[model samples]
Target: MTDMPLGAPGQRSVLRSLWQTQRVWLASATILAALAVFDPLQAAESAVFAVGALLNTAPFLILSIAIAAWAGATGADNLIAKAFSGTPLLMIGLGALAGGISPFCSCGVIPLIAALLAMGVPLSAVMAFWLASPIMDPSMFVLTAGVLDLEFAVAKTLAAIGLGLFGGTVVHLMMKGGAFADPLREGVGNGGCGGAKMRAPRPVVWRFWADADRRAKFGKTALSTTLFLAKWLMLAFVLESLMLAWIPAETITEMLGGDGLVPIATATLVGVPAYLNGYAALPLVGGLIEQGMAPGAGLAFLVAGGVTSIPAAMAVWALAKREVFAVYIGLSLSGAFASGLLFQLWTSMT
Candidate 1:
C-alpha cells in the first residue's frame, strides 16, 4: 500500500500556525463578512467608520510608533536594566516611574522581566515594573489620548504608576515576612533576545542613522510597530461599530453607568474576560462611555483588563512560581478596583 504523503501533515501544521498567529485579523474579516451577508448597509457603514477612525488617529499613531522605534534603536531598555540594582524601596519607586513613562515597547518588557527575575532581582521591585509596564507605555498614552481624551489618558497613566507602587509595596512587606522566597520557576534564567540587551545594555546611540546596522534596526522597528498598532486598532474600531449598533444604550447605562462604586466594580470584573488587547480595549472603552458608562468605570476596566489579560498572566506563569502568580493576580484586581474608585471620586469633584 502506498503511504500517505508526509507533505499533507506539514501543510496542515502550516495552516494551523497561520490561523493561530492571524486570529485577530481573521476575526476582523469574519465580522465584516458576516455583517455584509446579514446587513449590507451596516457592513458598508462599519467599513467607512473603521477607515475614518484610523485616518483620524493616523498622526498620533505615527508619533507613537516613532517614539517606540527610536527608544528601541537607542538602547533605552539597557538603561532600564541598569536601574534594578538599588535598594528594594528605591528600585520599586524607580520601577513604577520608569514603567509608566518608559518608551520601551511591550515586546521587550517580558524578556526584561524574565532577565530580572533570573538575575535574582527582588520580587517587590520586579512586581512594580511588571504591573506598571503593561498598563501604560508611551504608545498606549498617545493612542488613549487620541481615541478617548487627554484626561482619560492622564488618568490611565496615573493608574499605571499607582498600581505599580501598590503592588510593589505589598510584595515588599510580604517578602519581609518571608513570603515568596525563591520565586523563579525551574529552568528560567535567560532573558531571551530582549533580556540579553537589558542584562548588559549598550549605551544609547540616538544618532542611529550614523551607523548602518542601527539604521536598519530603526526601520524594522518602525514597520513592525506600525503594523502591530494598525491591525489591533482596526479590529477594535470595527468591534466598536458593532457594539454601537447592537448593544442597547439602556443596558450599558443600567449595568455600567451611574454613580457609586457599583459600576466601577462591575467594570473591573467585566474587563478580565472581555479584554483582548490594550490596543483593542481603548475603542471599546470609548464606545462604552459613549453609551453612558461612567468614566471611572472605563478606567477600572482598562486597568483591570490590562493586568489580567491572558498574555500578561501567561508571561508571569512562565517565569514565576504558582504562589507568586497568584499574588500578582490578586494585586492587579485590588489595585484596579481602587484606581477606579479614586478616579470616580476625582471626576465627581472636578
Candidate 2:
C-alpha cells in the first residue's frame, strides 16, 4: 500500500545513477592521489594497492551479490520479519544463519537492513543479524583460516554464533513490544526498487530457470555490485598501503603487545572511530598478526572495526531514536567484546 517510487526519483536512468555515485569513487581516488604528494613512490604504491585489493575482493563481492539476489528473489524478507515475531530461539537461529551467509560488511548491511525493515523484517531480528553477519561470514572464516590457525577459526565461529544468538534474545526481551516497525512506516522508505510490487512465488524449477535467465540478462547489474564493493575495498587498500609505507608495525605492537587484553581493547577502541569494510580490514589485520599480535585478537579487531563505525551508529540514530541507537551500540559493543573474550578463553582452554 505504500507509494514508494520504483527508482530514485528524477530523469536519471540506471547508468546515470551509477555515474552519480561515482562521486564517492572520485573522492576516494583524489584522497589517494593527495597521499602521493607525501612521496613520489606513494602514487604507484597507491595504484598497486588499489588494483590488488580489487582483484582480491572480487570473489567476495560476487558471493555477496549471489546471496542478496537469493534473498530478494526467495522473498526471505518476510520470513525474516516473521521470525522476529516468533520465539527468541527462532530469531536467534535466524540470526546465526544469516551471519554465516551475508557478505555485507556492517557498513553495506546498514542500507540493506533499512530496506528489509521497510519490507517488514522485525527490528530485533534485523539488528541481531546485522551485528552477527560481519563477524561470522564463511568468507571471513576462510580468510581467517588462511592467516590464523584452525583453532582460531573454530573459536571465532563459535563466538560469532554465540554472541549473535545471545544478543538477539536479550535485545528482543528487553525491547518487548517496542516500535521497531515505525521507521518503515515513515520518511524515506526501504531498499532500491522499493515501490516495485512483488510477484507470487514461482515454483522451484521455474525459479531455478528464471534465476539463470535473470543472471544472464542482469550480469552487468551483478557485476556492478561486485565492482562497487571492490572499489570500496580498493580505497581500504590505499589506506593500508599508506599505513605500511609510513607507519611501523613495531610501533603498533609496542603500543599494544601480544598475549593480553590491552591489544584487543585498543583495537576495539580504535575501530569505534575508523570505518573500514570487513574484508577491507583483513589486510590491515594480517599485517598486525605479522607484527606479533595474536590471531584471535586481530579477528576481534577486524570484526569490531567494521561493526562500530560512526556511520553505522549515525544510520541507526537517524532511522530510529537516540534510545534505540544507544541500545544498538551497546549490544554491538558487548557482542564484539564477548566474541573476543570468548575466543581468547577458547584458545587458552583448547
Candidate 3:
C-alpha cells in the first residue's frame, strides 16, 4: 500500500490538537452527566434553570453569530470600513444612527464591532455603535415599557440614544486631526474559514435553526451552541437567582429610597460593574423604585449596567489600539454619567 500522504497526516494531527485543546465539550458532558445523577426534584429544578438560560440567550446569540458570519464572508465589513473615508464629524453622526438601531446588548455587539474594526471601519463610527446600540434598540424599549411607566420609558430611551450620539461626537472631536489608530491587531480569520472552504450563501438565523450542520447533526448543534454560550449566561442566572432567593425585595427598595442625583449616581456606579442581564436588572430596578428611588435613576442604572460591560470592554482592548480603547472607556463612563444625570434631572423636575 502507498504511504499516507503528508497533508492527510498533518490534517489529522491538527484535528487531534483541536479536540484536545477545546474543553468546552468535556465540561458540558460532565455537567450533563452530573445533572442526570441528581435527585429527581433537584434535577428538575436544575434542568428548568438550564433550559431558561439556554432560551434567554439563544435568540440573540444565534442571530448575532449568523449576521456576523455573513457580514464577514461578504466583505460587508469593508462597507463599515468606508465610514473612515469621511470626516470624523460625519462618521460620528453615522455611528450614532447605527447605534440607535442595533438592539444587541454590549456583549452581543462585540463580535460585530470587532468585525467592523477589523475590516477598517472608522474608529469614530465603531465607537459610536459600541456606545449607543444597546440603548436605542427595540428590545430595550420593550423592556422599558414593560418594566416602567410609558413616559419613563420614552425618557430613558431618548437619554440612551443621546449618550451614544454625544459620546461618539466627543471622541471624534477629541481625536480629530490625529492619526487613525489601527483596531485589528493580529490577523483574525473570518467565520467558517478555519473549518471548511465552502462558499455557500450565508443563511438566516432561522435557517441555521432548521438546517443540518456539524451542530445540527443529531440535535447536537443546539446542545453545543448552548454549551458554548452558557458560561457567561450562567453568571447572570446564578446571581439573579441568589438575589431573588436571599435579598429581600424590600432591602433593595430601602437602599434606593430617594429621588435625587446622589441616589441615581449611586445606583449607576453600583450597576456599571455588576454585568446583570435584563432578567436580573429588571427586578433590581423595580425593587429600587418600589423603595422610592427616582424612576429616572433606576432607568439610568439599568441602562448603564446593561450597556457598559467590563468584559466587553476588555475584548475591545484586545482587538483595538490603546488609544482607541482608552477613548472607549472614557466615553462609556461619561455616557453612563450623562444618562444617569439626565434621568435624575428629568425625574426631579417632573
Candidate 4:
C-alpha cells in the first residue's frame, strides 16, 4: 500500500486542538451526566426543556445570523459609516436605531467597531452603537415578545435607543471638552486583542452562492453562530428548569416584585453581574415575571444585564481605556434605573 499521507498526523493534531478548546462543553456534559445519575427525572426534564427552548429560538437565531453575515459580506458597514459621517446628533439617533435592530451582541459589535474606526468613523456615533447594540436586536425582540409581551418588547427597544442616545451625547460633549483625545490606542487597527476589523467581501446579493468562497464562508459563519448561541442557551435552559423546579415563586416575587426606585435599583445591581446572554436571560426573566416580579424591575434587569454583563464588559475593556470603560458602565447602570422608573410609571398610569 502507498505510504499513508501525512494527513493523518495533521488531522490528529486538529482533533487534539479541538478537544482542548472545548472545555466548556466538556464541563457541561460532565455536569449533565452527574445530574442524570443523581436525579434522573430532574435531569430528563431539564434536557427536554433545553431542547425545546433551543428549537423554539432556532428560527430567530438563524434569521439574525443570516442578516448579520449578509451585511458583513456586502460592505453595508461602509454605507453605515457614511450615514453618520457629519451629523453628530442625527448619528446618535440613527446609530441607536441601527444598533437596536442589528442582531449583534456585545462581542459581535467589537469587530464592527474596529472596522468603523479603521474607516475613520466618528467616535461619538460609534459610542452610540456600542452602547445600544448589546441591549436588543430583531431576533432578540421577537424572542422577548414571545416570552413577555408586545408592550414589554416595545418598551425595551425604546430603552435601548434612549440609552444609546444618552451615551452618544455624553461622549460628544466630552469630546468637545477635550476628553477622549486620541481615544484609540496605538495599534488598535492592527487587530490585536481588540478584535480584527471586519473585512467586506466582494459585493454579492442573492447570487452569494455563485461564489465558492462566499458559500464556504457563509456556511462556516452560520455554524459557528449556531454553536455559540446553543451553548449559552443550553446552560440557560438547564438553570431555568432548576429554578422552576426548586426555587419558590414566593422568593422571586418578594425580591423583585415591588414597585418604585428601590426595586429598580435593586434589579439593576442584581442584573449587572448575574446576567448571561440576552436569549438565555429571557426564560429566566419570564419566570420571574410569572412569579409576580414587577414588570419595571424585570425590564431594568434586562437592560442592566445586557449592557454590563461580563462578556459585554470584556469587549469594552478590550477596546477602550479604563476610564472610558468606567463611564460606559456608569451610564448603563443609570440608564437602566431611569428606564425602569419610567416604565413603572407608564404601566401604572395605563
lDDT of each: 0.76, 0.59, 0.59, 0.73
In model 1, state the lDDT of residue 66: 68
Clashing pairs in 2: none
Model 2 residue 161 CA deviation (Å) reads 1.4
Best by TM-score: 3
On lDDT, the leading prediction is 1
Give lDDT: candidate 2, residue 50.
70
CA-only RMSD, every prediction: 7.3, 8.4, 8.3, 7.2
TM, every model: 0.61, 0.61, 0.66, 0.63
lDDT of 4 by residue, 232-309 (tens): 556655665665577553454466766567888998987875675688778878888777677899999999989987
Output the TM-score of candidate 4.
0.63
lDDT of 3 by residue, 1-350 (tens): 87667669777897788766554345444554565685445445544765686576567777765555555444354454554667866777777777777667654665566556555555566677777776657776787678766776687667666776787777666656664444454433222122112223333243333444522432442333334345544444433433344455555555556866677766666565553555456767776777667776777676676565543554455455666667766766667767778767666676
User: Where does model 1 exceed 4 Å of error?
Assistant: 1-83, 104-107, 190-255
RMSD of 4: 7.2
lDDT of 2 by residue, 89-132 (tens): 77667876687566655445644555455555555666677667
lDDT of 1 by residue, 1-350 (tens): 87657678877898799897787688789999999999999999889988987786676466655655666667664554566666878989988998888754433455456546644567789899889987898888999999999999999999999999999999999989988767776645433222222345467887888988888887986776566555666776787676556655445445666657888999888776566568877887888788777888999988998888755665676557888899999999899999999998898899
Better of 1 and 2 by lDDT: 1
Superposed by TM-score, candidate 3 places the C-alpha of residue 142 at a distance from the truth, in angstroms, of: 2.7
* Ten-residue stretch with the least lDDT total in model 3: 189-198
Runs of candidate 2 exceeding 4 Å displacement: 1-23, 36-38, 66-85, 101-118, 136-149, 170-237, 258-264, 270-332, 342-350
